[model samples]
Target: MTTPVTIVGAGLGGLVLSRVLHLHGIPSTVYEAESSPSARTQGGLLDIRDYNGQPALETAGLTEEFRKLILEGRQAMRLLDRDGNVLLDVPDDGTGGNPEVERGELRQMLLDSL
Candidate 1:
């Protein structure tokens, strides 16, 4: 029999590890400091780079789900002056290779996949 793995924290890394292990027919337990998934607010935005985060999610077999959490047009950037003049405007052409996703939403998606 294969021994189960113990993971600390239910953050992105821990959760991904657990999912990957589970896919390989292994079991793991994740321990988190929070009492529950919604115990606290998880606010923040992350750019899941194609070369980094995207590959990790693919390895965990969650690429499709991860893509669904991406916020459309978030890759665009704009700069305004005091006079409200647009100094720079970069539209999201969908080729930035780094899409944005809400931290909370991503966490929830990962949790649901487990």
Candidate 2:
């Protein structure tokens, strides 16, 4: 029989770990200090890279759900000078392997998946 796992937090890492373990028929319990998922506001944008976070989500079987939370046009970057001159401009051509997603939304998605 597989022993149950205990996770200390509900952050991305912990949630993802729980998810992956669950996928393989393992049981896990996540313990978070927060009273609830919405206990407080989470951070802002997170760049989920193809090499790391994307594969983790895929292993959790939440790639489609994660894709839905991606904010379009966020991959674009820009830089302006003091004189309001554009120093750099990078458009979001939808080719970036790293997509920006709201931290809170991602957390909620992971929580819901479990």
Candidate 3:
């Protein structure tokens, strides 16, 4: 008999793992402290890139869905001083592998996939 996979915390990592496992016909149970997705604020944006995050999404077969969530021009770099002065600003040339998307949206997409 195969041992079941139990993933703690329904955050990005756990959710991705669950989705990937599901795609490969593996079963996994995810445990999250929150009562529901809206129980707490999902918080902030995420930068998914070719090197790290994007690869994981691809493994889970979410590349197309992930692309739909990409927020253009979010990879632009900006450096700020203590006084809120902009030291450097660089626009996203569209080649910067990383693209930003809302964390909640990504989480929801993974959930829906499962």
- Give the winner by TM-score: 2
Model 2 residue runs over 4 Å out of place are none
Tens-place lDDT digits, model 2, residues 1-114: 999999999999999999999999999999999999988999999999999999999999999999999999999999999999999999999899999999999999999988
For residue 76, model 1's alpha carbon misses the true position, in angstroms, by: 1.3
Shift of residue 9 alpha carbon in model 2, Å: 0.4
lDDT of 3 at 56: 98
For 1-114, candidate 3 gives per-residue lDDT tens digits of 556799999999999999988888888999998999989889899888789999999999999999999998888889999999999999988888889999999999998998
Error of 1 at 104 (Å): 0.8
Instruction: Give candidate 2's whole-model lDDT.
Output: 0.96
Superposed Cα deviation of residue 1, candidate 1 (Å): 3.1
TM-scores vs. true structure, each candidate = 0.88, 0.91, 0.84
TM-score of candidate 1 to 2 decimals: 0.88
